[model samples]
Target: MPQVYIVYMGAQHASRYPTYELHLNLLTEIPVNCSPSESLVSSYQRSFSGFAAKLSIDEADKLSKREGIISVFRSKTLKLRTTRTWDFLNFSHSVNRNPPLKSDIIIGMLNYGIWPESKSLIRDWDLRQRNPVANIQKSEAVFDSEAPLVTSFSSRGPNLITPDILKPDISAPGIDILAAWSRVASVSNLPNDTRVVNYNIISGTSMACPHVTGAAAYVKSFHQNWSPAAIMSALMTTAKPMYPSAGQDQLSYGAGQLNPAKAVDPGLVYDAGASDYVQMLCDSGYNETMIRIVTGDSSSCSSSTSIGTARDLNHPSMALHVQSGKAFAAKFLRTVTNVGSARRSKYKAEVRADRRLNVVVNPSKLRFLELNEKRRFTVSVSGGPLPGNSTAPATVIWSDGKHLVRSVMVVYTDFSS
Candidate 1:
């Protein structure tokens, strides 16, 4: 007999009932044999096929990371496997132990799962099994009306020791999404072959991660030679901020929704190399030993890693809030490489200051860099020299003659010394 591996993919909670039922229906459609092993294998294939039918490759990748889904496959008979349960603790530990893998197709899934510590406070009160009256009371106890409901569900920062910064280097759609499911799962109440719909929506950083992953896949499919970092840079440079939803904060969406078409041909990408990240840590005040520990080069230490003075244009340490007042100055240096044509052209750097703060650009014009050549730029901010504490954001937009090239955020804070 040959080895077989089955993996399940998608969010774990029964809330994804529609998707589960779809997978079950797929299992029923597969041909069965007398052998139990073969039958089980058939069932797994049917279930995965059902999921694949409903999702693009990118969506499937996102599903694999969620608690309930199995993310990898290894079976002699199967060419590609899906939906085996993942060991997240082991997976996290393994990433620390090994270097990154080299592959032709690298699919990056970004989900902002709530901080494990914050889960108790923000667990969904509306889950079906909870007593409705009791849950309503509990909701009032846990959250205030002004507090955005779904914002906390986004993934957290200080991704400890992951090779790449754990944050959503970019954002996408992972929220109350409707897709395929398994019919046989007891939790799914829908009939097989029926396309069940989960109309109630969900929002979290998870909802946002897949949108960018799909875009990355699209870019990889087209530009097969690009590195993972390059692909990430392209997506970030070209991402758009989500328009203000009825009751959402800008922080929740980061740069906003993703535009894959724009990402594929970004006029210029803000590239960050390994050394750049190292320098960022150093500028932010980390010693060599501390840098090694934070970047996963060494074991954990007692003293906190210092984030000194320098801030990367894209560093996660800085955040701007509309109401808080704190005065600060930060600089971000970026190297922009033009992958396009060599013709010299004029490029302007524009800053779209949020209403709460004033921003000034030192050298607003960017000189042309030849194709394959790189250029560096710097930005600085002060919180309007106000009397009280306040904060706002400057959307630093870089543009060529035709379209906006890239936009990075400079968050301002006004805190008294």
Candidate 2:
């Protein structure tokens, strides 16, 4: 099947001809503000308005109808009269109608800077609406909790209300990540193209999500039977929360960071099947008809919803969010698949709270699976005095029996209280 790529077009490049030349110049002038100045705001409005005026309504509608095209513009406050009313809805419907091309995978390319827009949609869909059909419960619980707060930098959820849930089910490392860029696109385009190899550092959960996606691809290549839901479960349950050291403010590092190896071998993963999401929607007040509409099946309700089980609540994405708070503590979980054999491993956690809060894993070990087998684990803030509001540096450490696998910084701030 033809691969479908979904790229977010932030305000910087919302126009049709989003050339790098224009983007760079715009970047230089646009001030980073919650509410931009009138002149700048007006300029943006004029630019998009002009762009909209140039296109015939049909053409604009057609562009919006393209598969994988969704609104990634930030600030619901912005007046995107034409695009929001029709263009966006058209795009959403088109993607919903078309099945993925017979490709081995679907890749979604997102820019972290586009998060504000993404989150706006999610917040509205997941939190605001009642009788919603998407998995808003998980997101809602996470949003209310203090843990990481869904990386203020990442986009929010409640992607769409009907015809298959489309919220961001999980997160990945899309912040300050080093990735390859196209030299032709980076260098040949106007200003500041000095770097070779076309490599650049971009941040956002967008960077993080791709890491998980790539790992999922690897898993799929080996195990084709595993469904997308399974892959998502594995990734979500296996994530780690990285925090800053004492005397620091909460930084962007969330869930400690992504661990591909550990994720691949997580012992237990919080799974969310289709019915689980359906039930979550139901709990949020959706009825059978709403579920059918959201799941693209208006026929009879599936039996999965009839047999209520606690397993349905197993969602690591929600779990981590519920556990970790903003009080200078970080927590995350890992997921692993059962390759062939099941092994038991002893896992231990230790916390060092002082000038900085440090968590270390002891015996750094798990015993399961053969040479190529995998298992999952969860690391959390088991014990620690909540940090004061004053900014401080914090540290998180993960160690295996023989080696220190990773360390992350947790930044703190005293602004709120």
Candidate 3:
């Protein structure tokens, strides 16, 4: 059987026809019977500008050269299942045990829905016996332990929307997780299955979102006044590096895996304000009227507003794409705000990069005189010709010896040989 593949054509560049019409035209042009006769696997017009269709290796190759096409790849099947999440993240021991009130915070999860009957979610005694915290035992033996790893199915990225800012600000445990299940539906999602269980094991990026959502709620519980960006900063900065041997980049496992404990007190944060994002949108070539429509304000981009790149956004991690010459050089401007104790808040910059690249930080030493105080710094990277078309990976750590504010830097340069 011809396998299904997703043919991503990027954003619509065809102005003459509608999205569906364009897809129809493209399919018609191809020799494959992609119309109703053969049937398309799926059309991704709403979420993404792509379509899934059954294509032979040769047909897919031929279509790859089609105008506006970005990438053509085989559709992958991802597997699931999880707990040992909290234990793996060291969330059980490092943080307080008492769970926060469910009413105060709501963890929003974009997952395969929930199985209310799972003991990990709601114990039977809690419902029937009216015991609130009866089966709540934070023991290792009860929850099976495994070496923490990034799921193969979990998505990785060199963030498409904003290449400068890394997507998936942080990571969380979401493998072989035992959670509540939906009684009406089958566990494995097979149509013919006829089993209904209270608890089911599942995994995937969908489950990962909820874990971080819960952690964000936990952080919100402690710092109620913090903005969404600040909470995000805390999570990313406090995340624990994962599978060092894996040799992954920021795009691979983003800010490492989630650490709910250290996140609560991330000494410092690179916070982005609402206005800053608005400015970013403006810099992205959005007109004043369009910006107003989105922001819901009469906010206009004026001469006073600096027209900087997306990397200017005060994010925890840095990904700068430099298109330089023979002597390639670029500078990344970033600012960090002290969010921890003012008395002992002092940090120094540490640079780690490939030998071919020369990374330097200005005013490497940063001293915080008060909480909420902001310090600005620039990372200047100057390197010779990249042997071939290659990306140079680097890291800058702002550490006070107590808190390590790590930033992953990827310099994509095309220097003249």
> Each candidate: what lDDT?
0.48, 0.39, 0.73
What lDDT score is found at residue 43 in candidate 2? Answer: 21
The sequence of per-residue lDDT tens digits that candidate 1 reaches over residues 1-417 is 223334455343343455445454433344222232222332222213323223334333444454545553443342322211112001121222112222456574544432323313335334445565542221111223332233534653323333122233555545444322222232222223233332323344444555556567766775676666677767766766544455333434555546666666766666666666676566555676887877876533234544433445344223432223335554554566665544575678887776645566657876774665667766665554433433244576667866576554535223354
lDDT, candidate 3, 180-228, per-residue tens = 6778877655433467887677677767888888889988888767888
Sort every candidate by TM-score, greatest first. 3, 1, 2
**Model 1 per-residue lDDT at 339:** 59
Predicted structure 1, TM vs. truth: 0.51
Q: Which candidate has the highest TM-score of all? A: 3
> For model 1, what is the C-alpha lDDT against the true structure?
0.48
Better of 2 and 3 by TM-score: 3
Superposed model 1: Cα runs more than 4 Å off: 1-103, 108-169, 179-207, 243-246, 284-310, 313-326, 385-391, 410-417
Each candidate: RMSD to true structure? 19.6, 19.6, 9.6
- What is the lDDT for 276 in model 2? 60
Instruction: Give each model's clash number.
Output: 50, 66, 11
Candidate 2 global lDDT? 0.39
